[model samples]
Target: MISVRVNGQRFQVRAASIVIHDGHVLLHRAADDDYWSLPGGRVEIGEAASATVVREMKEELGEAVTCGPLVHVVENFFDIKGEPNHEIGFYFQVALSEGSPLVDKARSYSGLESDLRLMFQWHALLDLGSIDLRPAFLRNTLSTIPLVFSHVVHPGADDV
Candidate 1:
C-alpha cells in the first residue's frame, strides 16, 4: 500500500462494492462508528481493484461475489477525528448469487479480523438517505445509478 500522510493523517486507495440484491445494498460500518460505507478495504500492492472487492467480500461477508463492471470512481476527501483524510475508491458492481449466507442472515454480524472487531449491515435503498453514508455523494448515486463510469469528487466535509 502506498499511503501518503498529510499533517499526520494518512490518505489511502480503497476498493468498494455496490452489491445490490433485492432492492437493498450491502453496507459495512464499524461498531464504534456511526457512518456507513461500502464493504471493501485498502488496496494492497499490485492488487487490482476487482480482486480487492472479491477478496473483501469473502472476508467481510463470508460469501463469494462475481465482480462486475466498474460503476463509480470516487475521490473522497474528508476529516476523520479532525484529521484530513482522502481516499480514491473504486466501486464495482458485485453480484451475490442465490444461497449466499449474507442473502438470508441476520441484519447485523460481527467479526474479529486484523485485530479489529467489525460490524456489517444490509440497508434498503429506500432507507439510505436517513443514515450517514460517507462520501455523501454515494447516497445520491445509489438512487440514480449512472449509466457509465463516473467520477465523484467530494471536497472536504462541506461536500457531503
Candidate 2:
C-alpha cells in the first residue's frame, strides 16, 4: 500500500499514461527495465495538460494522437532519499490515427532482442492488471472523481 502526501493530505500519484491502439493499450517495457507503463512522461513548464500528453507521446512514442476528453487525475507522493516528492498525474483516452510510433534510444533492455535503439512493444488489455505501473487505467473513477467514459456512447451509422 504505497501512498503519498499532497499539501498535508496523504495520497499517491506520481506518473500517468494513456495509450490506445486498435482498441488496446500500448505498453512499453524499457530495455533491462522492469515494470510495464504507458508511453508518457512528465509535464513541462508553461504547458497545458492537453499539450503535455501530445508532446510526451511524440517524444517517447513518435506517434501523434488525437486526445479526447480529460480522463483521470491521480495524486501520489514518493520518498526520494527519505524526502517526500509530489506527483499529480493525468491520464486520458487518446486516438492514434496518424503517424507510426517511434522508439526512443535503447539503454537497458538488450537481451530482449529489440535491435532498435529504443525498445518498442505493446501489451494486451488482459495483462494491464498483472503489471506493476504507477498510475492505473481501465476504470471509471480515478482520484475519487468519476470519469466520463466517452467510448461508452457510440453513435449510430448516421453520425459516421
Off by over 4 Å in 2: 1-15, 79-84, 99-118, 136-160
lDDT of 1 by residue, 4-99 (tens): 897777799999989887777878887788899888888888999899989887886677889999998888877888888778889998988677
Best by TM-score: 1
lDDT of 2 at 117: 36
Residue 40's lDDT in candidate 1: 85
Taking all chains together, each candidate's TM-score versus the true structure is 0.88, 0.58
Candidate lDDT scores, in order, read 0.80, 0.50
* Residue pairs of candidate 1 with colliding backbone atoms: none
Model 2 root mean square deviation, Cα atoms: 11.2
Off by over 4 Å in 1: 145-148, 156-160
